[model samples]
Target chain A: MFRDITIGQYLPGESFIHRLDPRTKILSVLFFMVGIFGLKHLYSYLFVLALTLTVILVARIPLGYLLKGLKPIFIILIFTVGLHLFLTPGQILVEIGPLSITLEGIMKASFMALRLIFLVLFASLLTLTTAPMSLTDGLEKLLAPFAKVGLPAHELAMMMSIALRFIPTLIDETDKIMKAQKARGADFESGNIWQRAKSMIPILVPLFVSAFRRADELAMAMEARCYRGSEGRTRMKQLVYRKTDLIVTLGMGSAMVAAFFFL
Target chain B: MIKIDNVIHTYKKHSDEEVQALCGISLDIQEGEFLVIIGHNGSGKSTLAKHLNTLLIPSEGQVLIDGLDSTDPDMVWNIRSRVGMVFQNPDNQLIATTVEDDVAFGCENLGIESGEIRARVDDALATVGMAGFGNKEPHYLSGGQKQRVAIAGVIAMRPKYLVLDEPTAMLDPRGRQEVMETIHRLNKEEGLTIVHITHYMEEASQADRVVVMEDGKIVAQGCPREIFSQVKLLKSLRMDVPPMTELASILNEAGLEVDKTLLTVEEMVDALC
Candidate 1:
């Protein structure tokens, strides 16, 4: 159930998109985002929409899962549309209670809303296809050059991976702690917002204490394994780009660029 | 061989008050032998294990892994690589999400090449009887499997001496049994020197040597039969003997003809017949 929080979660599959190198997927997403932000005409938006849908279809991610990921951002989407529709000054289309809707406002709001939706879709699509480990590996390699600039590329990547690894563990621990507190007649539900907030303290205290203890033990175990830092480390999984990865990444990048500049 | 020479560790509790965790302790862990350390909590069983791998430096004295001193700044990694440690909790030790990656963690940290790391990971996984579970996530594993994975992670470093500190303490009975068998197999089949620490006397009874600790000192050291035969002394130190040994002691006290040195259920069965 904890894993069913589909936002930024991987859906294991053997689709064409899923098999692509994580670096390829990440770069394509970046290219599409840049193209989307620069597009001016409506046809380009339509082109980008069709291409996103095609990519998602190739990725074979269920429509329901993508929609679920967008649920948390629905309010933000609506707010963006509303603010642009009412606050922009232009040739008036309608007015209600000191708020005027204009022709330019209508165009602006639609584009803004479409932009937000496309951003969410592409971002979730990236995470949906790539396993968290692969994503972090790709990131570490991509960021490796920045190490000389004092970036700590490997450390950052390691932190990201370790954070992902512990998510399920922490969720289970939180569940256990909550149940233990509830068994002691501690109420977590059927309370006011403030009361519910207060009820969480009992769970938080023990969770923090145990998490710190785990951290201490983990550090010692790591030291025992001869882990000093990322200075001389080598990974088991190497990110290699295949023929399909190259073709797909190039195709997607150029298509987005074409849509943005020539559509 | 791992040699601990007069290791005295004084742990700072709030800086002002200090508790001596390991008091002038010296022990020789010979090559290819199964040695188990049994003690109650705060009896410095873990502290002694930690000293083996340089996780805790001796306040005064020395620890040497195959003639490399743990106190030497340059030899820390060498000492650690020679004496790999597996801690009590399996959940906390695995840094990678997947089993194979976690196994390769130590090898990677040691700067082994990619091909060599892969080979070692595969070999380690097979040795732990977890070859097919390389792709499995850590959270999906049972407690025993996780501990085995942790063991795999340690052995992937190619350590000669394995030090486990209460590895089965957090496991269920089945999990504990799985871990015990795995360690025993590693000790017997691979001829790896193992220094295990546990409070479970049953587990200790199978070791080549048993070291009993009390108040930060090794009070007794001998073979399992010899160690378990002194039931009253062990009981006085708040330690338990194996069930069969305890039964033998009880039966002997009742004027029955039973050997007090019995360590296993089969032995008890034979003596009863």
Candidate 2:
């Protein structure tokens, strides 16, 4: 069941968006998300939505796969929309027995929902286009200036990339452990909420132990490989910006500027 | 040459119940030699291998690699770079997502230039016969392939000595054979000195010299023929000889004219025919 979750997953492609520098994609997504929130008019939101759609089109990711990522957030989206619909005090449009829906509430809820949808899509697009390793590299490069202020940018990047790399591995290990526990007559389903959470102890204990063991062994291996706190370490694949990155950054900048001025 | 002089390693030395892992082990590993250390569990073989790469300093004596002391604070990185190590668990050792990136890890740690690192990475991958697999994810590779990638990672550092602690212990027979062949090729063609620690007697049979440890001390050390010939001593030490060696020894004791020193099946077949 955990396999169906598509967040933090990368889909490899040869599209223009995929070929762009990871920094470019990351900055574009950030700018787009901020611009999406700055828009006060429906026309600007529509423009942002169109821009997101164009990026998805250029990325060539299947629309079905992209929508599949939203499955888990469906309930949260509905709750937000519902909360906005009932709470916003405005001119009533539709009346229920006790609760009344108003024009302002409908408009506010739809806009908020659209913003949420666009936020998820833009973030997912960045991950979908760039590999996690390059994403961490981009983050490290962007944060390098902060190193003078006692920030451990390299270590942070390394930790993030390692965590990303181990997600699938840990998931597979969890699945194996769950099956092993199930074979021993452990039931994770068909129980009360507290009972189910309690039953997870058997799985959690071994998973934590194995993770600690792996971490220890990995630390030893890293030390044996001459890793001394990432000092003077050079990467094999250096991140460099291309003309395409400049073009995309400029285009995104102008779009955000346009949203700020006209909206 | 690597030298171990009166080396003694103990775990939890400050505790009241100190366990001595290695007790006064003195040995010299010659340059370009394929040396295999065989022992049962808790026999200090792995502890000794870690000493070679300075992963663990000795509690008593010292390990000198090319005249550089292993315990010296300043020479720690130098020792590690000179003696690369491949651990048992490939998954734990492989830190990168892709094969090529993992191979380049050691060089990157060494602060090599990107152009030189690329050339070294490609060369090391080709050395391990993992060419054209640069873009492949390590998790998707087979056990043997991942181990080879680990070896390639060590090779990229251009270390003079390669120390592997039961690299094939977690692999299937085919994977074992693949890793062994890679190690052998690297030793023969590249002239890299190897210090392999394993429990597999068959793997020990192929080494240029074998050292058998029983209780944190070397019980026997000699060529394969000389070591496997003493079947009774090995049996008393709770270690197994190669299957052919055991069979030949059993046959010799059964009033048959067979050489107990035969370590391979082909040699037994020829002797019997």
Candidate 3:
């Protein structure tokens, strides 16, 4: 089931948004985040919410799946809302001894919560649509200007791409090791906290050893195939922004402007 | 072609108990030959195979792959490019999500142009009979298929020689057969030199020549029949002969006139009848 957590979490589709360049997608998501935070009123918030729903609809990603991706951070989301409600000082609307609720507190809670939710949704949209390799290429291109300052932009991108590539592999390896250990009567469930933690030792040691060995072998394999850093490297699939990318940028930019006036 | 002259390899040098992986090895491998090295655990066979690809340099002496010294820093890339290696675990060797990307990895690393890399990737995948499954994720493949993809990765580099280190050691029977057959085809049809290191006696029996190792030394080197015929010597080194050869030896002890050169079960039955 852990394999379901695809490294980039990209959902393949032929939708207009999905077909846009990853660089365009990334920039659109960044603008969406900025728009969400720029909201100064309930009308602006409403516009952002509507845009979120429209994008999700066009992308055709199941709302349930998007919510599932957010499951890990439910506690954090709740904490943010609760902290805002309790900490923001204003004309007290309700009081329970040390805890007071105000209109500004409620407003701030809604703002912060909506900001985070839309932020995650938009970012997940980028990942769900763009292939990991394309995302890395877009990132490298975006960061290419920084190479002049000794940033090692290409190497960094290569590392990210390789890491993304190995995520599923390592997960599969972990699954195999777990099954192997389980066959040998290694208890991984129905134990206290410490016992459960201790059970991971067998899994951890072998995984760590195998990871190191794989890294060594991979280095040798890379060298064998003549990998000499990112210099002089050309990709089979180059990232190129198209007319659709420009349209999407304009669409998101218009939405941001609309939100400034409407909400 | 490869030339190993007095190669000596040791691990944990200057330790109380140092491991001499290869004591002293001297051999010449011809182009387009299938050479198999068989040995028990910790017999230095894997270390020897790694030398051909320049994965490990000799502690002493020399390993020349197509006249490029393995120890020479400048020649390391040249040697490695000519001698590609495939390891035991397919998972460790695969660096891409899709089969096509995995095969392209080797070519891409070689700095080949996009068009050339794509052509080579398709050719390599087709060579291993995985053309249709190029877009599929590696996890979706069977064990044999994954190993074939690993082979395709090496093939994409278009190396003159392939050094496989116990590639089927972790595969099932079906997977082993798939990999061995592919190696056979690569050696026979493509005329690519192969240095296959494995512990399975049956797998080694298919090679043009067999080299057996024990305690960092090559104890035996000859045609498979000649090498496997010495059952007593192989047993003394804790290595096994093919099942048919063992059966022949047993029948010989029982006063049967069956030849000891038989390797496969079918051949043994023919000789016995």
Better of 2 and 3 by lDDT: 2
Q: Highest lDDT among the candidates is held by which one?
A: 2
All models, RMSD in angstroms = 2.0, 1.6, 2.6
Q: Which tens-of-lDDT digit does each residue in A1-263 have in candidate 1?
A: 36566544788899988888998988888888887877887667888878889988998888887888888788998998999999999899898989999989888999898888898899899999998889999988889889999999888988898888888888899999988998999998878999999998999999999999988888888888888888788888888889988898898788777766676
**Where does model 1 exceed 4 Å of error?**
A1-3, A242-252, A255-260, B251-257, B269-273
List per-prediction Cα lDDT, in the order shown.
0.89, 0.90, 0.84
Pairwise DockQ winner, candidates 1 and 3: 1
Question: Candidate 2: misplaced stretches above 4 Å?
Answer: B13-16, B254-257
User: TM-score: which is higher, 2 or 3?
Assistant: 2
- The DockQ scores of all candidates, in the order shown, are 0.82, 0.81, 0.60
Estimate TM-scores for all models. Answer: 0.95, 0.97, 0.92
Question: Which parts of model 3 are misplaced by more than 4 Å?
Answer: A1-7, A173-205, A250-263, B13-18, B250-257, B269-273
Residue B32, model 3: Cα distance from true site in angstroms: 1.0
**TM-score winner between candidates 1 and 2:** 2
Query: How high is the lDDT of residue B148 in model 2?
Result: 96
| Candidate 3 residue-wise lDDT, B178-269, digit = tens | 99999899998999999999999889877899999988999989999999889899989887778888889888989987888888888987
Looking at candidate 1, what is the lDDT of residue B59? Answer: 98
lDDT per residue for candidate 2 within B193-231, as digits (tens), equals: 999999988898889999999789999999978898999
